[model samples]
Target: MVSVASPVRQSESRGSIEPILAVTAPDMKRVNDLILAMAGSNVALIPEIAEHLIASGGKRLRPMLTIASAIACGYTGEAHVKLAASVEFMHTATLLHDDVVDESDLRRGSKTARTIWGNQASVLVGDFLLGQAFKMMVEVGSLTALAILSSASAVIAEGEVWQLSAAKRMTTSEADYLAVIDAKTAALFAAAAEVGPVVAGSPEPVRAAMRDYGRSLGLAFQLVDDALDYGGSAADLGKNTGDDFREGKLTLPVILAYQAGNDEERAFWQGAMEGGRNDDAALLRATALMRRHGTLEATIERARHYGEKAREAAASLPRSPSREALLSVVDFCIDRVS
Candidate 1:
C-alpha cells in the first residue's frame, strides 16, 4: 500500500456521505444526464424499466468512488465522467438481475421492475444496460479500465449463479460467504475505484490503493446490510426487513450464529434455513437466536473492522480533496450500523 502523511478522523461525516457528494456533485449530474440519454431505446420497455430502477434513490456510491478516485489521483479530464456512468450502469444492471433472481417485491422503497414488469422484461432490460455499459467503456478508450469493469461484470454474474446453489445450504462456511460477496459486491467497487487512477495515468501503487479502499468499503457496506436484515428497518434497507432470513439466505450472521451454536441451536438453524421453517415465527426465532449468540453484534463488529481497513486504504492515497471524501465515505458506511 502507498503511504500517506496523516490519518483523517473517521467521525468527520457524522453518519453522512456529504463529503463524497460535495466532491462529485457536478460530475454526478453529468453522469445522471448521460444515464438518461443512454437509457433511451426505441424498444420502449427497455428504457421504461431501466429508468424505473435508475431513478430510485440510491446514493450512486460506486460511480462516485470512480469519480473521486480519479480526481484524487490528479486526473483533470472528462473521461472519468463516462467511466463513472459506466460503473453505475453495471451496478444498476446487477440490482435488476438480483431482484429477478430473488423474486423480490421491493427495491429502494419501490416495487421492483420484475414485480411491476415481470421477470422476462427485467432480465432483458438488465442485458440492455450491460450492453450500454460496455458502449460507455468502449467510448472511454482505455482497455485497462474496460477490462476491469468487464471482468467485474462477469464475476458478479458468476457470484449470482453460485449463490443460487449455496443459498440455504447448511454447509456454506464463512469463507464461502466471503467469496460470494467479494465477487458479487466488491469486484465492481474495486474496478470502479481502480479505473479512476488508471484513467489518470497514476502510478500502479496509487491505482492499487484505490482498489483496496473500494474493496474494503464494499465489504463493510454489505456486512452492515446483512446485519440490518435482522436488526434494521425497511426504510433504511429499502426492502422488507428479514428479507434475507425469509429467502433462506445464509448470510454472515446466520453462518456465525450457526457455527458458534451448540447442538440444539444448530438444529434450530438447520430447520429454519434449510428445512423451510422460514415463516414469520421462524424469523422471530432466528432473530432471537442470533441475538442470543451475539452474532448480530459480532457481524457489526466485522463491518467495523473492514471499515477501518477501508480507511487505512484511503489513507494510503496521496493527500487530496478526493481522498478525504473517500475517507468520509468509509465513515458513512460503517456508521449505518451505529
Candidate 2:
C-alpha cells in the first residue's frame, strides 16, 4: 500500500522511467535525440509553443510502448524511432486540447499550455503537432502506419465529444462512461502498441495480442487516473483533487457513489455537481459518500482487474526482454496513485 505519510512531494515524475528494453546508455541517447529532432520545428510562428509543451517532460509512455513492442516483435528497422516520435506528437496534441476543454490550469505541477499561453495558442499549436505527426508518418511511408494513426485520431475526437455531451446527464450509465474512456484514452494506446508489429509485418495473432495488451493497460491507466482525482492529494495529483466534481464530470467513482448513495446523498451530489471550485466541501463529502458506499474500493478493484487482463494480454508475445519489460510496466500502471 502507498503510505499516506507526509504530503506527497513530486518525486521524479513517472514519465522519466527508463526505457524498458536493455539498450546501451549510448543507444538510448540516440533515441532521445531522435525524439527531440522529430519534435523540433521549422515553423516560425508556432514552433516555440510546440517545443515548450513538448519539452514539458511527459514519461513518453506511448512512444516507449511503440518502441518496446517493436523490439519484442523482433523489429530491426530504425523506423520505430520515427514512429514512436509520431505517437508522442499525437499524444501531446491531445493533452493541449484536453487542457483547453477541461479549463485546467496545471499539468504535472506546471501551468498548462492554455494557462501559460492562451486557449487559442494552445489549440493552434495542438493543430501544428497534429500536422507534424502526419508529416512524420509520411516519412515512414507505410500505408499501414497511416491507417493505424488516422483511425486512432478519429476515435479520440469522437470520444471527447461523447464525454463533453454526456457530462452531468443523470442518464449516463457505466457503459456510457466506459465508451468515452475507450475512445479518448484507450484508442491511442491500442494504436501505439499495435503499430509496431503492423509496421514490422508480425503475424496476425501476435498483432491482436499486442492490441489487447494496450487496450487493457489503457483502461486500467484511466481508471487509476479517475480514482486519483477523487482520493489523491493535490501534491501527488499535480492539480487540485475533485476537478471532476467541480466540473460536473461523472467519472467511475462518482458514478458508483451516485448509484450507491441514499436519496439524501444523491441530492447532495446533484447540488455539488452543478457548483464550481468553491464546492470543495461538497467534494469531500462526496468522497466520503464513496467510501461509505464502497465505490472507492470498487474503483480500485476494477483497476486491478483490468491490470490483470493487461498482463494476460502480454503473455502471448514471443519471449524477449522487451516483453518482460512491458509486463513490468503493466504492474506499475495500477500501482500509480496519480
Candidate 3:
C-alpha cells in the first residue's frame, strides 16, 4: 500500500474540533433535535433510511458553521437553530444522492443508505429530507437565507451533473475540476455560512467574509480527502482507500499525476481512469505514480493554500471563541493527511 505522511503537524488538541463543538454545543443540541423531528415521517421507511445516514457519525461541520457564524456575528435568536438544522438536512440529502450517483457501498465506515435501503428508497428519502429542509427554511422566514440555500441546492445539482460528465475524461483540467467542486461541495458551505449573517442581519461585508471562509474551507477539505484516498488508511478515510480510483473519479491528485507523468505513466493512468484497470494492483500502481510524481504532496499543498485563504477570511470576523474555533477547523482539515 502507498503510505505518505503529511509534513504539517500541530498539537493533537490543536487539530481537534473540540473547540468548534464546545462553542456550538447548545445550538447543535437543538439542531440535532430538530433533525430527528423533521426526519420523522408516516412512511416508516423514510425515517429508517434518513436516520441510517443521519446518525452515521458525520461531524455535521456544515451545520456547525451555520451556528458558529451566527453566534460570532452576535446573533441571539432561535432562527439560527432552525437554519442549522436545515443546513444539515441539505447536506444529508446530498450524501444520499451522491452515494446513489457514485454507486458507493460505504459511507463514514458503515453501509451506505442505498446499500441498506436500496437506491430508489435512498433517493426518495433524500427528496423527503430536502422537502423538510425547505420547510424549515420557510419557518425561519428569512428570504435572504432561503434564497442563498435554494440557489446552493441548484448549484450543487449542477455540480454533480458536471462531475458526471467529467468522469473518466482524461483531459479534465484543474479549472474544470475546481468548477465542479465549487458547486458540488463549496456551494452549500458558502450558503451555510452566509445564512448565519443573513439571520443575524450582519452587514454584507461580514456575510461575504463568512461565505468566503466557508468556500475556501470546503475547497481545502475536498482536496485533503482526494489526497487521503491515495496516501491515507481506509480507517482515516471512513471508506476504502482508492475508492476514487476504482470509480474513475477525476480529482486533483489524479489530475496532477497525469500532467506530470511520462508517456508510459500516462497510458497507465488513462487505462485506470477509463475503468479498465480497477484491480488492487492498479490502485497500488496509481498510488505509486502519485507518490513518485509528488502529486499527493502537491495536492495537499494546494489544499493548504486554500486553508490559508480560509484563515484570512476568518480573520475578518470579530474576535471570539467561535471565530478561533472556525480557524482551528481550517487547521484540522489541512492537517488530517498527517
Candidate 4:
C-alpha cells in the first residue's frame, strides 16, 4: 500500500481552512439562509432530499470560494451572497446527480439521497436544484456572472458524460484524465471564483487571476481525491475505500500503474478494469501494485504542482485576509492526505 506517512504532515499547522471560514462566516450565514429558503418547495420530497445532501457536512468550499473572491475584490454588495448560494446549489445538484450515476450509497458519511429516494427522484430533485440555482443567478442581475456560471453548468454536464465514456477504459491517457477533471470539477471552481470578481466589477486581469487560482486549486483538489481513493480509508473519503477500482474507473494511480506494469501485471489490470476480478483480493493487489510503482506518490506530486500554481495565482491578487486565506486553501487541499 502507499505509505500513510504523507509529506503533507510536514506543515500540518498551515492546512486549516479556518482563516477563510472566519473571514466569510457572516456572509456564509446569509448564504445559508438563502439556500434553505430557496430549497423550500411545497413538494416535501424536494426539500427533504436537497436538505439531506446540503446539510450532510460538506465543507461548502465552492461557495466559500465565491464569497472570498468577492470580498478580496472589494465587493460590498449583496450580489456576491446570491452568487455564492448559486454556486453551492450548482454543487449540490451535481452531487445528487453524481451519486445516482455512480450508484453510490454514501456521501460525507451519510446515506446518499439516491439510496433513500431512488434514482428518478434523485435526478429530478437535482434538476429542481439546478432550476433554483439559475433563478438565483438571474436575481443577481450580473449578465457576466450569469454567463460564466451557465457555461460552467454545461461544461460540468459534458464532463460527466466524458467521464462515463472513459470509465472502464484502461487506454485513457493522463491528458484525457486531466481534461475530464478540468471540465467536471475545475470548471465550477473557476466559475465560482471568477463570478466573484465579475460581480465585483473588478478589471479583467483580476477576474482572470481568480479564475486561474480556482482552476489550479480545483485540479489539485481532484488529484488528491483520486489519490485518496487508493491510499486512504472510507472515513477519509466518506465512502468505501475502493469504489474507484470496483466501479472500473481509471484514475491517475491506476493509469500510472498500468503504464509501468509488466505483461503479467498489465493482464491483471486489464481483467480488473474490464469488470472482472474486482473483489477485495483484487483491490488489495491493485493497491500493492500502486505502492510498488509509487503512482500514489507521483499523483500527490502532480497535485502539489497544481497547488503551487494556485498559490501563485492567489499571490497576484491584492493582499488581504481573504487573499491570504485563499492561499491557505491551496495548501489545505494538498495537505489533507496527511
Best by lDDT: 4
User: How well is each residue in 114-141 modelled by candidate 2, as lDDT tens digits?
Assistant: 8877999899888877887888888888
Name the 10 consecutive residues with the lowest summed lDDT in model 2.
Answer: 1-10
Q: Judged by lDDT against the true structure, how good is candidate 4? A: 0.91
How would you encode candidate 3's per-residue C-alpha lDDT over 195-288 as one tens digit per residue?
Answer: 9989999999999999999999999999988988987877777777789999999999899999999999999989999856878899988888
User: What is the Å distance of residue 150 in model 2 from its true position?
Assistant: 0.7
lDDT of each: 0.86, 0.77, 0.90, 0.91
Compose the digit string of candidate 1's lDDT tens values, residues 1-338: 10110121234446568888999999999999999999999998998998899888988999999999989988889999999999999999899889988889989789999989999999889889999999999999999999899999999989888888898898898989988998889889889999999999998888888889888888888888888888777776789888898888889989999998889989989998898788988888887887777787777777888888888988998788888999988877777655
After superposition, candidate 4 runs with Cα above 4 Å error: 1-4, 7-13
Q: What is the TM-score of each predicted model, taking all chains together?
A: 0.95, 0.90, 0.97, 0.97
RMSD of each: 5.2, 4.1, 1.4, 1.3
**TM-score, structure 4 vs. true:** 0.97
Output the better candidate (1/2) by TM-score: 1
Q: How well does candidate 3 score on lDDT at residue 223?
A: 90
Clashes of 4: 0
The pairs that clash in candidate 3 are: none
Error of 1 at 112 (Å): 0.4
Q: Candidate 4 has which clashing residue pairs, if any?
A: none
